[model samples]
Target: MARLFNRTTQQGSRTSLPMATTLPMTLFMALQSRKTRYRSTLVVLAVLLCLSTYLLARSSSSASHTLLHKDMPSDDQMPVVFEEASHSHVSGTARKHRKVHKDREQVTLDPSQELAAISSFLASLPQNVIPLSVDPSVTVDPQLVLDFDTRSPRAAAEVQHMVADVWLRNPVFLYSKLYSPASREVKAMLAKMDLRPAPTIIDVDIRDDAEVLEPIIKRLSSSSDLPVLLIGGKPVGSMKEIRLLDKSGELRKLVAASGAVVDGSKKKQHKH
Candidate 1:
């Protein structure tokens, strides 16, 4: 009995010794695992912080750009003088100030009155000057191409009559615009020549039928330019042609040939 009890006690002590050793090893492995997880969490936080900072910086820069753009002025908001300067510099063409007709009375005529006026002006021209037929090679001004298809039949007819009265029927016609520098220059030049039975200067821009008349004038002149000069119902030319004619001393001859008298002491004067 004593020997059996000693063997049982030895086996129990062996089992307890192994359990005590394994418990400390398990605890050490658990502590190492927790430390590794904590390190990984810290690295993840650092990366997130860097990413957040970069995003914030990008957003701030975008916001600043937006604000700057919003503060910039649009073309419409710019001063008139500045706008004028910009436009004048675009084609290097000198922009003359509109100085004519500031004190002149405004004349508005009805369709019938307009027709009568045109007829009277035609009658006043010397009998020797006749309406010349348009040249076929000269393309009609695209502006004069009437969109009769869109207009009421009656409206279209009225416009047609007006166009004929102004361009086709009249022997002397000056197609101009109120604000055009070239038109003003042409007028100034014509004034100096003192053409007898002066050409009717129609400022299409100020006409009530501007939408229709403007295009017709453009088409009849076969040009998109302002200040179309017509003599004997034929296009004499725009400002450029007039200048050329004047330079060569042929303008007076052309005017006289059209049965118009040029009598002005200021005939020798020219526009710079």
Candidate 2:
């Protein structure tokens, strides 16, 4: 109403009697109820204040997020300035393609030095004795079968040497195992050493001595041109014995009596 009156006044308008008179009374009554009106307005104002506070908090949070995430300057303006600064930090480096040369080594050997070295090595070992404990009548075949297991330490070592020797001369010589264990080692023993005189020997250990002895005797007597020397009551094979006799002296008469060539003074005495 005051605004209305002020507008009216500004327009230079005159108020009529009825409006002029009623306006004062209405204004007076409104003024008298001003406390009640003010209280109702205060309640509405408080609700509006709460709504404003919520809007302000929301706006503040939105502004904070925008400030946190975005560049500080306005969108239309340059956001940041940059400068290419010199970074002259000191550093050390190593190269990979490096070459190194090594000198040639010298090899030297002296007769005295070699002799001393051999003597030293030989001195470390005990005497090499071919353990001659096995029986010679075990088997006629090179495959030595005895009453002893060849796996025993003494037997294995001896047999290893014997088999090696057998192969060294007659590679056809073979080996076999025994089913039982006895004092005899089959490897060191032979049916007839006179065939091949092996220094590494196994003595006779035949269970049935006669059975073994008879066969050897028969082989000897069956041949007219063969004479075998029986040593230790065991008949030796003339196949090996004859070759040995040719190399030794006394065996020439036996070699001649058999009507075989006496490879002794007779061989030299006979004309070509």
Q: How many clashing pairs per prediction, in order?
A: 3, 5
What shift in Å separates residue 209 of candidate 1 from its native position after superposition? 0.8
The reply for model 1, stretches above 4 Å from the true place, is: 1-171, 264-272
State each model's CA lDDT, in order. 0.56, 0.35
Q: On a 0 to 1 TM-score scale, where does candidate 2 land against the true structure?
A: 0.15
lDDT of 1 by residue, 30-59 (tens): 999999999999999999999999999999
Score every model by TM-score: 0.37, 0.15
For candidate 1, what is the TM-score? Answer: 0.37
The digit string of per-residue lDDT tens for model 2 on 1-272 reads 99998998866644566677899999889987997889999999999999999999999999999987686555433212322211111011111121111121212223222222212211222231111332323323211221122223244454444433333333112111132222122232323223332222222222223234333334423422212232222233445554465456434444233333323344446665
After the best TM-score superposition of candidate 2, give how far the Cα of residue 83 lies from its true spot, in angstroms. 33
Instruction: Identify the candidate with maximal TM-score.
Output: 1
